[model samples]
Target: MDNTGFSLASLLVVTALGLLVPLIVTRIRAVRIPIVVGEIIAGVVVGKSGFSIIQNSEWLQFLQFFGLAFLMFVSGLEIDFATLKPTKVRKGNRYARFLTMPPVFATFATGLTFVLSYSLSQVLFNLHFIKSPLLFSLILTTFDWLWFF
Candidate 1:
């Protein structure tokens, strides 16, 4: 589009509306979900798929990167390191098992994914169906979260 598409007014209005949707949805029905979900949906609506408010601005890219970094920093800040102390604090046996379970499950999933991808790659390569194993590896890694869950 043109410079008129990325004007300050458009950005501010889109951002406000994005924030407002989740607020209004949660307030009206008394249900709760993350604000980030609303923000992502609003982004899709205002993106090329919908109204096309902003079109690939460099400033917006930079701001998105900075926002992600800031969120990670804030998450790290909230972690309670003191709770993990062995002498000063006591933890139930279940806490240790719970912590180990997620990692174990993740490890198993990663290994299974690798094995499946490798077997598929071998069969496809033998049949001349696919050009490269690297391409198959990339496809496996690019799985959508919605599909996995």
Candidate 2:
């Protein structure tokens, strides 16, 4: 791919279309999913898994990397660390228990899911390009503060 593929127009138009199509899908009354999931679906559809239509240039990948890092930082900031403190009155308080549930839940769920469907021919499975199912599960279960306020 030519370096010229990283132009601002290409980046903005493609990203906008990817996001916009999902937004449009969410407009249907029966479709209750969030825009973020829609964007993910759109990405998979256009990505190497579906059509191999969009080849991400290094610049685009870098931008996505930066955005993900910033989003994760923001999500971490939103966490109320005070709620996580151990309390004597309660063996495990509500907030603390709630915080613990996701990691435990994700661990079991991702492990089971991965164990059940871990095989795919290198030709059909695009996620194998990442080479680590553990990393994929972590990425999948990462908090989507993007979904909440």
Candidate 3:
């Protein structure tokens, strides 16, 4: 194929690698790592940072977008919204029930996370490990929700 055109062989290779990563991860029982982590490492090895084996193409970009959307959709499906309903708190005022709601609790937890992250980031900044504590804290805080799904 021409230099500008996409190759089907490259797509096949990517697909095969994607399928093989999980199997490889499972086969090595001693080394415990998430499949997603393994896949990311494999991608880095094959991508421009390592070998430049996987050429960027329109079809690959489209597939990447679709895959991300599908992953988010599947992750969102795991949430149990029904449990988010407010529950009664005995011997408390009207606002107590509202405080018991999952969103309120989540907000409180997020705030706590930001506070902790900011403190840690401040230490890192003092040590010259990072430039901006606020930005680093924000990044760390943002990743807190990723574990939920």
Q: How does each model score on lDDT? A: 0.67, 0.62, 0.83
Worst 10 residues of 1 by lDDT: 82-91
Give me the overall lDDT of model 3. Answer: 0.83
Which regions in candidate 1 have their CA more than 4 angstroms from the true location? 1-6, 28-33, 56-58, 74-101, 110-149
* Local accuracy of candidate 2 as per-residue lDDT tens digits, 1-149: 55446566547755786658776976857646675567667777876687766766767778678867976897788897665554344465766565465555556766765554444322224744656655555555553544444
lDDT of 3 by residue, 62-103 (tens): 778887898789889989988888766787676777668889
- C-alpha lDDT (0 to 100) for residue 138 of candidate 1: 57
Q: Tell me each candidate's TM-score.
A: 0.47, 0.46, 0.72
Better of 1 and 2 by TM-score: 1
Between 2 and 3, whose TM-score is larger?
Answer: 3
lDDT string, candidate 1, 17-42, tens digits? 76688776567444454566556777
Error of 3 at 8 (Å): 3.6
Clashes of each: 0, 0, 0
Top-scoring candidate (lDDT):
3
